[model samples]
Target: MLTVRFARLLLLAALAVLPTLSHALACKEGGRNGNVLITEDIGTTVAVPVTENTGVPIWHSSQRTVNVHCYKDNNVREAEEVYFYPNPRPKQGQPQGVQFGVVYKGQAYYQTERIPTGFSIPQCPSNVSLDKCPAVSFTLSFQVEIATKKPYPGNGQVGINQFEVLQFDGKYGINNAPNSNLVYKVTGLDKIRFIQCAVKVWLNPPNNTLD
Candidate 1:
């Protein structure tokens, strides 16, 4: 009984300390600002944008995009590249340009062929309707990639083991943006049968200045 109690106490202590340690690590990984971690699990079909506390422009003014790659237990299997065009040509279609699909176990289970447009208005004039003044937005999608050879019974859901986010510099031309890439390594994927996923990214201020 004493040994069991001691183990229980240790477990409680570790659980209590884990959150603090995680926060510290996040800050450290992010440097002075710390890293912004986002996770999407089953049933979550929306992308949540990540905002900075320092109040600096994190995204390029004209070209804003996020590249997401899904991994199966650490190996990348599918990818999606979404582009947000603030002022896309009329009649061209939605401002969100998407290129990619969600694949699992070497088979594509979902694709973003007709996803809806995601947009938001930061500020609206007194007379202008908030919906009319669009400022920024993005879309999110999710799916389970199960092994095709031997499918599991029931939901057959295979949670996303890991994923990666590649935030490109919108200010610089696409050709040069690769040189200034900001990659966020995300882990601890949800274990639910189905996964909810959302992704939001912004460009960090250059030199921490408003330039």
Candidate 2:
């Protein structure tokens, strides 16, 4: 009876150790679930104001992209392209001109010199009143490709020139535009050409306390 009990105890211990051994072996063979290698090329951050408010300043509507070059172990994927659509023209004004270039309010603007292919938004927050808080929103429109662009290389040129302002209630900053906030129109998207790239972006309202 003593020998049998000892044997049973040893068997239970072995069973417990087996799972740990199996997990250790699996981890050793698989590595750390791999790593998500992120190579980001963020273009200059231009402070485009929310024309609707005078004192309450909003920022970060400028086009940006992050080129996810690989997954783990530097594995390459096919090239992809994304073409984002700008906001439509507001009710008033001549609807700005893309031919002469982008113009936010009365200021002239230019597209980012370089934009990456794949990117994502980590978080977003919102509010009903600008005085109490501000909300952030992100919208991206573009195309992707299955074939990689490399070696000989291909061009991934995407034009990002357009404006879209959120309408703020009177409770926010000094509401300027008719809708209480600012409004923008995307005049051109059909006129540009890009090879293999995906466009990703966000429209976020800054916290009112900042201003």
Candidate 3:
């Protein structure tokens, strides 16, 4: 009977201490297990201008997208270059310049496609009605897979398991003003499964210009 009671006390002590140790392990800066989730911009859209002074041509003044690509093998790299080429067409009314060549760079596995969402209106004079001449907007959706590998005890080796973002817009901004980075977390495992990522990008037009 005395042994039984002693064993029960020891078990309780272990349970209490185990949690404390686990908490400490969880607090470590870089543990074996990590997280996997794609980050998206918080804002809805960023406005870009389609002007001559601008470095390149773009589809719309503001645009956003989520892209993805499926690979047959895992030997691919995370920083692989993905290009998005817009459909070609002559500039409306102006029969002068070429109208295409807006490529967005992203991971190699992701495909090239713009997933448009909506439009925006630049600040114009009060006398000007924005309904007819409102600035255009495009939106895209991003998707990333969740990590499947259990957190090991060191820097985890994670791949772009599966990811994509929808792209919106055709024209590029001057100096590439409207741009941001994708947010990601190494929260857990190396292999990830169905995770969702959403972000929006837009541009601010040139100080005084239009397309």
TM-scores vs. true structure, each candidate:
0.19, 0.16, 0.19
lDDT of 3 by residue, 139-173 (tens): 33323321122221122222322122222222221
- Name the candidate, 1 or 2, with the larger TM-score value: 1
- The C-alpha stretches of model 1 lying farther than 4 A from their native spots are 1-160, 170-179, 194-211
**CA deviation > 4 Å runs, candidate 3:** 1-110, 118-133, 136-170, 173-175, 178-211
- Give per-residue CA lDDT, model 2, range 1-211, as digits (tens): 9999999999999988654232210000112232222112223432221222222221222432222111111111222221121222334332111222232333332332213212321211242222222222223322211111112112322234333322111111122322222222332322333334344454455443432
Tens-digit lDDT string for candidate 1 (1-211): 9999999999999988654332210011122232323333323332222221222221111122232221111111122222221211123222111112332223342232322223221333456542343222322333322112222223423344344422211211121112222233223333323213445455575346443
lDDT head-to-head 1 vs 3, winner: 1
Off by over 4 Å in 2: 1-178, 194-211
Against the true structure, candidate 3 reaches a TM-score of 0.19
Deviation (Å) of 113 in candidate 1: 9.6
